[model samples]
Target: MDNAATTKITENVLKAMLPYLRENYGNASAIYSLGQKSRAAIENSRIKIAENLKVKPSEIYFTSSGSESDNWVIKETLNPREKNHIISSKIEHPAILNSLKSVERFGNETSLISVDEEGFVNLDELSEKIKDNTKLISIMFANNEIGTIEPISEISKIAREKNILFHTDAVQAMGNVKFNLKDIDVDMLSISGHKLGAPKGIGILYIKEGVEISPFINGGEQERGMRASTENIASIVGIAKAIEDAYANMDENINYTSDLRDYTIEKLLNIDGIIFNGPIDNRLPGNINITLKDTKPQTMVQYLDMYDICVSSGSACAAGSINPSHVLRAIGRSEEDSLSTLRLSINHNNTKEECDYVVEKISEGMKKFKNR
Candidate 1:
């Protein structure tokens, strides 16, 4: 149910990476035969990802994590030397929000556009927020906590009309949703491998052609000098294989997981004081967010963990924080409801039986907590 945090690496992806981790252990920068082989593998992975996104191979740049990708794109696009302003929504993942804060620290202005109660970014507010100095409009393809998919194409069109650079933190939507970069006119997008059943430490930033931004890391002339570092060949191979598998089985997996998610939602709704957050029709197929009016999510999460059933109160990155979810607040959930919210994000691996068991546990926890 915590697939949003990260996913277990698929066996096939691990198999594809084993050889590189052992026998082909060579730095991609070396001109030797073994190193050249590693370099070729890295380029191949980049091409594979680019093809899946319907973008040119040269546009793909790998990073250590989705957070790094988001940070780099924002930092590069918004130069602090100038009075550049950025526009983003209030419900974005912490990675994007924190990156914006970093720019804000350097005196770059930012406008966090409001969202509707359903968690969709207010396009009117966004359009109004853009100024002559607005350099970029960064929004997430989907909300991590509430499972709301944004109107990305519409947002892109607005950005294009206003001549502002657009970037989407698509870390949560890359594998779970089907999209083509050629069909959308965004300047840049970010994706994470771990969300798609690849290991952590491998992420991608897609920069459209002719969109010039400064280099992220400054060192050896790697990644065509845009990002300079020794590439992780094994993880790169794993991410490529994982993304390939994801697209290959996208329709089938989405249908199956959506059925499970709906079934779980139906059963959970039978409980008292159940409030479903986010739009039912415009949400990710695998995500279900709900709040029990009288219950705290952490209390239910602790009880669920006791049964060895994993779940999350909100973003796993904010696991220890007692603060109300920023996403719920954006959607107009009261502080009480925000504290009571639970995010159940499914994946293809989950089954109807497993969802039923989870619902049962939640019902039991509600009873136990109510009694207390």
Candidate 2:
């Protein structure tokens, strides 16, 4: 239900974090015994996360959130030089787009690749945008709003051939997809903890060996002086546990959620004036974004709240804004179509009953809207 924005933390992750919050509270930079213990815990978490991604622990840099990681990668790659050119897609999360806007204020150049009706970027156009001055290519592995997975491997290959740095905001695709750093070979990648069932306020940036970049924050010698400030030991530990749990059960979880997604889509399709956005098959397992013609998404969300069913129209980060979804617009949706879009992301914890209830409530909501 609330899967698009975030997910409820699992009991295991919570349990792992309790001890650090309660007794093991110590600064990781301190040389005391307690500090050493906390530092060891952080290191272990980094190793586990790196193992999952098939990267060395030294390659992972923990930060405040996925947004911070994305911003850092962009600024670092384009800094200390005059020619500032970045390539990204239009369907990226606002974290990347908005940060790029900030970079542009300093005379940086950017090319936003447009997507097709299914929200997949035009790779041929993407190739054409790359120039000798293009410093970096930052794209999302999956659309947070429509759940369309991008051909990142292909994109990364192209960037490699062009000698351009590549970064992917894998926040939405981390737990849901199988990715190995060795295969992707991107220069940088961003991931968040809360998206995979860990707590918020913690994220990871994987910097491939030999990638030169500047730190976003400066203070103490943490994260090998790449990032500063005392580490969030509890959250980092929980993030590792969350990633380990998610990866271990990924296959079963994907199968279960995909079944729920298919069922939900089938029922919603039976309803009048509803259309599914994004690719039918090449999307995340639990994502189902739909446009309900003749009904406003805000009104639908309010009504669904009465049934204790939570959903979203787009990225939660951009919630409460009246603007139409940029991702939807990138996919060629009209303003009305964009305004009517509703995102119902699912997870392994969601039940078949929940999907049926959502469909029933949506149908009833539509009738009310029609009558009005």
User: What do the candidate models score in CA lDDT, each in turn?
Assistant: 0.90, 0.90
The digit string of per-residue lDDT tens for model 2 on 119-171 reads 88889999999887899999899989899999999999899889999999999
**Model 1 clashes, total count:** 0
- For model 2, the superposed segments whose C-alpha errors exceed 4 Å read none
Please, what are the lDDT tens digits per residue for candidate 1 over residues 1-372?
A: 799989999999999999999999899999999999999999999899888888899999999989999998888987657989999999988888998898888889999999999999999999999999999999999888888899999999999999989999998898788888998778999989999999999998989999979999999988999999999999999999998999999999988888888889999999887888998877888899998778777888999999988899988988989899999998898887898888899999998888989999999999888624
Query: What TM-score, over all chains together, does every model reach?
Result: 0.98, 0.98
Worst 10 residues of 1 by lDDT: 363-372
- Candidate 1 structure, TM-score to reference: 0.98
- Which stretches in model 1 have alpha-carbon errors above 4 Å? none
Candidate RMSDs in order: 1.0, 1.0
Model 2 clash pairs are: none
